[model samples]
Target: MAATEATKAADDAYDVIVLGAGPTGENLADRAHAAGLSAVIVESELVGGECSYWACIPSKALLRPVTARSEARRVPGLSDAADVALDSSAVLAHRDAFAAYWKDDGQVRWLDSVGIDLVRGQARLAGPRRVVVDGGRVLSARHAVAVCTGSRAVLPNIPGLAQARPWTSRDATSAKKVPGRLVVVGGGVVGVEMATAWRALGASVTLLVRGDGLLPRMEPFAGHLVAESLAEAGVFLRTGVEVREVRREAPGGPVTVVLDSPPGPGGPGGTPSDEIIADELLIATGRAPRTEDLGLETVGLTPGSWLDVDDSCRVKGVTGGWLYGVGDVNHRALLTHQGKYQARIAGAAIAARARGVPILESDRWGAHTATADTLAVPQVVFSDPEAASVGLTAAAAERTGHRIRVVDQDLAAVAGASLYADGYRGRARMVVDLDREVLLGATFVGPGVGELLHSATVAVAGEVPIERLWHAVPAFPTISEVWLRLLEAYRG
Candidate 1:
C-alpha cells in the first residue's frame, strides 16, 4: 500500500495515521491494524528509522565482535588467539549488512504486508485529525494521529564545530574508515559506546568528560567500573574539561579541539589547556527531540518543544484526544525498547477508545497505560563492563522520600561468575522499599549482566515482595545465582 504517484496526488484517509515509521511507529501501526483499524504511516527517510540504520543496530553490530574478542581474551586458555587485531573491512561490511545497506525496501514491504498504507514524505499536522505531507498531500484520520518522530544528536554551540563537520551518533556508527586519532566529547552512553568501539578498532581515542565521570545518571559505581574498564582499554579519559573551540582547515583535514579547564580547589578561574589534534572529532553530548519542523504552530503547539502526554500517550492541551505523541517526541523513556512499549500501550488505547470500550485501569501495569516508563524502565549500556539498571537508583529512591534499604553483592563471590571468565570483577546492588518490603530498583555492572536486568525489571514493575522473590529460586552454576546471593545479603 505504498503511495504511488497516483495515490500521492489524491486525498487519502485512514482510521489511524502515524508519522515517522521508526520501530515505534511501526509497532503503533501494527497494533492499530491488529485492532481492526485502517492505518497509514508517513516517513521522510528510511522506514526503519534511526535505530535500524544508525543508533542501535549498526552500533551493536560494531560492538559484538569487540566484545567477543574481549571475552575470549579473558578466558584462561584463549588469550593468545584473541590478541589478534580486528578485521576492519569485515567489521564494516557486517555493520552495513545489519543496517540493511541503508535501504528501506524491507520495511516498506512489511508495512504493505500488514495492510498499512505508507506515504514516502515528511508529514505534519495541518489541523486536528488532519496531516499534510511534504507536497501538500492531505491525510485525514478518523480515530487518531500519532507522532513518533524521534530525536537527533545535539551538537554543542562551540565555535567552528558545525563547520568542522564533526561526526554525530549517526556518522560514528556508520563510519567506514576508522580515524587514526579520535576525540570524543561527552561521557554519556553515545560517547562511551562510540569511544569503546573506535578504540577497539585501533583508534587512539581521547574521551573528554565535562562531568566528574561517565554515566552520571546511573549508580555511582557503575560509572567507576566503566571508567576503570575504559582506562584499562587504553582510552585517555580527561574529566572536568570542556571544549571551547573547534577548528578544521579543510573537509578531510585534521581537527583541532581547544579545551577549557576549570581550576581546582583554592585555585584561580578557568584556563585554556593544551589543544588536541585529531583525525576526527565526535560530539556525543546529548539529544534533542525532533519536533521543530512538524507544523506544530498550526495546531497552537510550540515548535521545538517536547510534547507532553498522559498515561495513555495522548498529547495534552490538544483538543478531542485526536492527537497523540509517543516515543522520544513525548519525552518519555528514549530507549528504542521503551519507545516500542509506549507504542503498544498507545496503540491499544487508541483501539479501545475507537470501539467505545471503557479504559478503567490506567494505573501501573494496566493494559492501556504506559506505567513502566516511570517505575521499571530498563536500560543496558554495551561497554566493556556492561552497565544495566532499572527503576530508581538508591539515591533516586531516597530523594523521592522513600524509606529504603540497600544491599550490595560482590559478583566475584559468585561461583558461576568466576567460571565465566578468569579474574572476573563486578558488583550488584538492590534498593528495597523498606516500608513496602518490595524491590524499588537494581543495578548490575560487569560482563554478561545485561541479560540479568529483566529479572530486576520484573521485580520492580510487578512490585514483587522480597519474601516472595526468595521463593523464585535461581538455577545454580549460573551468573543468575547472584540473585540468591543478593537475597542472602539483604537478610543478613
Candidate 2:
C-alpha cells in the first residue's frame, strides 16, 4: 500500500500525468504540453505501445509485401515476375525492420524532442491524483491523469492449452522465422490478416473459424469474398468448428490440436478429430483492456474492467473529473486512430479545466469533445482485398432508428476498378439517411479501397447533403470513381 498523501511527499509533480506511452498517451501528453501544461508520461514497456511495435505496424509491414506482390500478379505484364513464391525469410526480416527491431530508443528520443518527461516503470493510482510508480516512487498530478494503457490479445479457454504454448498477436507479428505449418484460430481482422500473410510467406496455413464466416461484424459479403480468396490461395479454411484440446508433447516440437464436432445445422455434436499437427498455433479470438493492474480499484473503479467515460473521455462515477480514460482503456472505440483522436480532445479539456476556463462545448465536438468517435470512426482491415468502413453499418443505422436508404455498387463494374486490375473483384455500400439525405455510413471491400475511406469518413462526418455530393466529381480513371457510381445508384 502506498503511503497517504499526508505522510509521503511527491518525488515529482506535473500539471498533467499520463499512464502508458502508446500513441494515445503520447498524443495526450503532447496536447497537454502544447496547452502550456507541464507533462510526464509513464510506460512499463516499449513507448510505442501495441500499434507501433506489434498490432498495427509489424502486422501491416508483413501484409504490405503480400499485397504488393498480389497486385503485381494481377497486372498482365508483371505476372511472370510475380509468379515466383515469396521468400519467407526476407518477409520476416522486413517486418523486423519496420517494428524497430523491438526497440524503443527512437520513440524515447521523440518524447525528449516534444518536451514530455518519460518515466520507465509500471504506474498505479494511489488515491485521487496521486500515483505510485514501481511501488515506491511517487508522482503527483495537479490537474488530471490520463489512462491510455491500451489492451492485450486474449486466448480462449481450452483443455491443455496452457501447456501447448500458443502465439498471440505479438508473436504472430514479430515471428522470427515462418513456421512450416501454422494453424490460426479466430476469424476477425488479426486472424484473417495473419493467415493471409503467413500463407503468402510459404507457410501451410489452416484457418479455423468458430463462426460460419469471417469478418462477421461487417456486411456478410465481405466475409464471403475474403473467404473465397483465402481458399483460392491454398489456405485450408474451415468454419463452424471449435478447438477442443491442444497437445504439445515436447517443448519446441510440433503442436497437435483436437477439434470438436462441427456445430453446423447438419452436425449438432457427435465426433472429435484426434490429431491436427502444426508448427505453431495462434489464438486471436479477442482483446481485453490493460486496466487490470492500473490501481483503478484505489479510485473506486473496478480493476480488470473497461473504464466508462463521457464524450470528453473523462471517467464517470468519480467524484471529480480529474481522472480521464483514453484509448482502448475507455472502450469507446478500440481502433488506435480513434484512441488518438480522443486523447487530443481529452488533453484540451484537461488544459481548459486547469486554467479555470470553462469548457464551453459539450456535444458540438468543439476543441474539448470527442464526437467523431461516436459519429465517424473509421477502420481498415489490411487483409487481402482490404475491408474499410466508416460511421455506422446498415444494421446499426436501422437499429438506431434512422430511416435510411441503402446504396450498393459493384466495384468490378466501375471503369477505374476494371483498369486497376484485370479481374477486379469487390463491393461498396453506403447507408444514407432518408430524411437528412446525408451519408450515415459507408463500407468498401476490395483492393485499394482503404485509400477511399477518408472521403467516406469526411462525407459521413461532415454530413454533406446528397445534392452537394453529386457535384463533388471524382477524378477520371481512378478507383474513386466508385463514389460517382454509388451516387448514381442511390438516385435511381
Candidate 3:
C-alpha cells in the first residue's frame, strides 16, 4: 500500500502521533484509539514491521519444519520416515507465505478499521508534540507523540565488511536461495538460530563465536546444551575467534573472511588465523536502537542515543511529559512481545494524561506500569534442544544480591519425557528467592520446552508462592510433567 495523504486540513491535529508502524507502534495506536483518542501512526517501512517481514515470522517459519522432523526422528516408528532430508525450496516458499511476501495490505486495513490514520514516511521530532514527516508535512499532536522506531542490526567494523555485502538477520531470514557453505559470525540468538535454520536447509554451517560460548546472556548450562546439539547436528563451532576482515569481489561472488587469533585462557594454539571462504557470510553481531536520525536534538535530547523512560514509558527529560518512548527505542527489553507490552502500558498512560487524570497510578503491575520489563521477561530460542527462560538466571539473581535457592532436575528422569523421545536429553533449573518464597527465575532446555515457558512466566509475574504452585499440577503422560519433577527437586 502506498502512503496516502490524509484528507484532513494541514492544521489538523491528533491526540496522539506514534512514530514507526511496527508491532509496538501499531499496538500503541490501537490502545490509544481504544482509549477514545484520535491517533495517527507514521511509518517509513512496511506497516507490520521487522518481526512481520524479516526477523521473527520468517525465521520461525523456516525453523518449525526442521524442528518437527527432528522430533519425529526421535520417536520410534517415525524415525525411518523422518530421516528423509528437507525440501529447501518448499521450506523457503512456506517462509515467504508466512511473511505475506513482504506486503502490508492486511496491516493497513487493520489500522483503517481501528480508526487510526496511517501516514507513510520517515518521521522526525520537530519540537514538543510536533513531528515532521520527510515529505514536508508537519504533524501536530495535542497530547503526546510516541517513538517506537525499534532497532537495527549492527555489524562489526571488520575491514571490507561493508563491501562484502554480508547478510544481516534480515537477509538470512529472507534469503531466496540457501548458500552451499555458510559462515555465521557471532554466537547470539540470531546467529545460532539462523545457523540452525540454514544448516537444516542443507548449508554447511561454521559458527564463529568471539566469546567462550554461545548465548552468554542465558544460563551457562543453556549454552552448553545448545552447543552440544549444534555439534551433533554437524554445525562446526569455533569459539574465541573473531572475523578481522572480509572481501568479496562481486555482488554474487563468494566471501573471504579473515580471522584473528583466539583470545582468553585455554585458547587453541594451533588454530588457523586466516581465510575462511564461503558462499555466504552472516554477520549477526548485535543490534543498535534506531535513534540516530529521529531529530531528537530539536527537542533538547541527544540523537543516536537510547531514550530513557519511566514505568509509564514517558521520556525521562523534556519537561511537560508530552514525549514518550517505548519498545526498542526505550531499550527496555528488546524482544517483540515485551515491546507490545510496553506499548499497551504507554497507551493507557497517554490516555489517562490526556483526560486530565490528576494522579497517574503506576504501581507495580498497574495498568499504566511496565513491571514485567524488569521483573519477568520471557524468551524462547527455537533451536534444537530449545532454550526457554523467564526472569533472572541464578547468576543474575546472585549478582543482584538475592539469597536464592537453585534447583536442578534432569528432564530425562521425567516419565513423559522418556516416552516422548527415545533418548531425550535436557535439563531444567528453577531459582527460588528464599525471602520471597516465590520463583525468581526458571530455565528449560530441551525439545518441546518452548510452550512450557509460559507457566514459569506466569509464576514469576504473578509472584506465585511455592506452596500455591504445588496445587497447580501437570497432566500425566506429557512433557509438562517435568514441572512436577522440578518442584520435587526444589522441595528435596
What C-alpha lDDT values do all the predictions have?
0.91, 0.89, 0.90
lDDT of 1 by residue, 397-442 (tens): 9999999999999998899998988888899999999999999999
**Candidate 3: tens digits of C-alpha lDDT, residues 1-492:** 223445345545989999999999999989999999988888989999999999989999999999999999999999999999999999999999999999999888888777788887889988898888884888899999999999999988889999998899999999999899999998889998999999999999999999889998889999999999999999989888878889999998999988885444323455557578899999999888888989999999999889999998999988899999999998889899999999999999999998988545547988899999988999999999899999999989999999999998998888889998989999999999999899999999999999999999999999999999999999998888888987888888
| Model 2, residue 348: C-alpha shift (Å) | 1.0
Give per-residue lDDT, candidate 2, residue 72: 85
lDDT of 2 by residue, 1-492 (tens): 111111234448889899999999999999999999988888889989999999899999999999998888899899889988888888888888888999988888888887788888899999999888889788999999999999998777899888899999999999889899999999999999999999999999989888889998787788898999899999988788889899999999999978874435413244444357999999989999999999998999999999999888899998778999999988888999998999999999999999998886655758888888887999998888899999989988999999998899899998898888889999999999999999999999999899999999999989999999999999998999999999988888
Candidate 2: misplaced stretches above 4 Å? Answer: 1-11, 263-274
Return the number of clashes found in candidate 3: 0
Give the candidate order by descending lDDT.
1, 3, 2
List the pairs of residues colliding in candidate 3.
Answer: none
